[model samples]
Target: MIDSIIFLIKTAFKNVFKNWLLTIASISILSVCLIVLGSVMLIVGNINLFIDEIGDESQIVLFIEEDLTVDEITQISDRLHSISNIGNINYKSNSMILEEYKESLGEDAWLFEDLDAETFRNSFVFNIKDLEKYDQTIYEVEKIDGIAKIKERRDVIERIVDIKDVLTFLSFWIVMIFVIISMVIITNSVKVSVYAKKQEIWLMKYVGATDAFIEAPYFMEGIIIGLTAGFIAIISQIYVYNNVLSPILSDLGFINPLNIDSVMSVIVIGFLVAGAIIGTIGSAYPVKKYLNV
Candidate 1:
């Protein structure tokens, strides 16, 4: 058994070294594929991170009754704070709103000089646990005693929610494309390697070697190739982050540092698995087709 193991090891190495160019070519192609796939994965993750950052403070603004006294509005704000899914509640009076308008518009804010914060009405800004419940929660708020009307951010929230949906769809399509292309490229590489060794495989079969014995070395080669590609992909991703992604994320101001790490982990695992399976399947087809004799 030990001798057989030694032979297999020796043979695997010999094959790997003998087909140096072929091995390099196959691994290189897989490396390139993994890098591109990794980039797509990173982009997907960044989009998700951006969406989540925006969602952390997701809220609905309720417009309070203009005639409601200060005490009444305070009671409503206090009641909202007691809700299960509610986070923090920020109550801004109409006067405060007008001040913010002036600050925002600068010199042009003078156009609204005729209006005071009272014109804007007091709004209750409260967050919810789940964004999907926003509309229902707003409906509930409208029923409150001091709420004359509710001005939930229907337009902006809908746009943000739509972006999340688009990002999720994009992730699926991107993953599908990665799988297909990775399979094609890796399988083609394995096929080429097998083609070059077709005569050797036939000789092994003629010498009474079982299929398992004949396939062992190639399988190991595939794993090694996969590991190599994974390493390359990871290094490439890190380089991209340090030299590209990080700088861009920094400019964006809310980048989560773990995003790149998550992306690299996914890509490395993805490439390794892809490489192993494609190598195994690709080798199987050629061996079955050309070595059965």
Candidate 2:
């Protein structure tokens, strides 16, 4: 069994080298496909991270009417607390708002030194636990009496959500398209190698060689090509993501991109597994058609 395995490995390597051009073509095609797929996955992942950051930081501010009674304020607080999706509700007095505004102004704060603190309204500022319920929460808050105006970043959130959805859809189709393309290219590559040694395969079969024996080397050839392509793709992806994309995104100010360390394992394992599966299927399909002998 050990000798048979060694023989298979040596034969696989010989076949791969003998068809070096086809192997190179297959590897190049698959590497490009995997790189594109990895990039799309990274972009989608960062977009998701950005969405979560936005959701966590997102707040709705309800400015209160100046003439509201203490009882009305208490009732408003009670109503807000009763909402299932609301989280971390806090009331900021006009004075607190003024102080915060001053802090935000930094060196320019003196320009507003004479400004009346009462110019800012007392407001209920809170986060939503479920952004999907944001519109409903806003509608419920609007029905409350003491709220004079509502301030929210809903427009921005909605736009981001739309972009995420569009990208997710595109990524799914892109993966499907590339998988098909890779399989076809790989299948043709294996077919050419198999065709080159058809007479030898027929003689081996005539001498009682099993189908598995005849097919093992070709399958190994496909797997080696896939593994080489996957490795190259991974290196290229890491370089582009860490050196090129990460710097550009970090400079964007608003984006909080994920660190490569956080997702490196996932990318590596996913690409390798996907490549192996594609290679196996590509090699198996072509070899089966020629094995009737």
Candidate 3:
């Protein structure tokens, strides 16, 4: 068993280096495919993170009726509290709204100097626990008597949610297509390697060599190629994300880009696993088709 293992290891390395150009070509293609796929996953991951942050902080703005009494306001507050999925319920008086507007205006606060705080409506701001029930909650909130107008940040959130699914689906298919192409390239590479050693393989087989002995070396070759490709792809991805993409995203205040550590952790495992599977399958196919004799 030990001898067989040692022989397979030696032969696999020999085959890999003997046809260095083809092996390199296969690895390069696989690395490029992996890099593209990793980028897509990272982009989608950050987008989803940003969306979740926004969604978590999202709120409904309920403008109160100017003529509603204190009792009516209390009733409205109670009604809001009674609703399911309600989180924090904050009451913003007209004065508070005006103050916020002034703070936002900064130098332009002078333009609003003549306008009274009473000109702004008093409102209730509500955070919700579940985004999926947003429409239903909006409907319920609208039916309340003391509400003069209703505004929600849900429109933007809903649009982002829709876009998220579309992007994920499209990116998945795109990555899958690239993976298939890479696998085909690797398969051909394996076939070439196998053909180069056909006479040796036949001689060994004739001399009572087991099928496993002949096939083990090719399997190891595939694994080595996959591991090398995966490592290279990860390094390339990190460089591009940190030096190229992250700097640009950092300048954009609205975007919340993912930290490198988190992304690396996921990509490392993902790349290694994907590379191993693709390598194993690619190597197995040619061996099954051509070496079965």
Candidate No. with top TM-score = 3
lDDT of each: 0.70, 0.87, 0.86
Residue lDDT tens for model 2, 158-191? 8767877898999999989998899998898889
Q: Which residue pairs show backbone clashes in model 3?
A: none
Q: Among these predicted structures, which one has the highest lDDT?
A: 2
TM-scores of the candidates are 0.68, 0.74, 0.76
Q: Name model 3 segments beyond 4 Å from true.
A: 62-124, 127-154, 251-253
Cα lDDT of model 1 overall? 0.70
lDDT of 3: 0.86
Evaluate residue 28 in candidate 1 and report its C-alpha lDDT on the 0 to 100 scale: 78
TM-score of predicted structure 1: 0.68
Candidate 1, residue 59: the lDDT equals 65
Expressed as tens digits, the lDDT of each residue in 222-249 for candidate 3 is: 8888888999998998998888777777
Residue pairs clashing, model 2:
none
lDDT of 1 at 114: 85
Off by over 4 Å in 2: 62-124, 129-154, 251-253
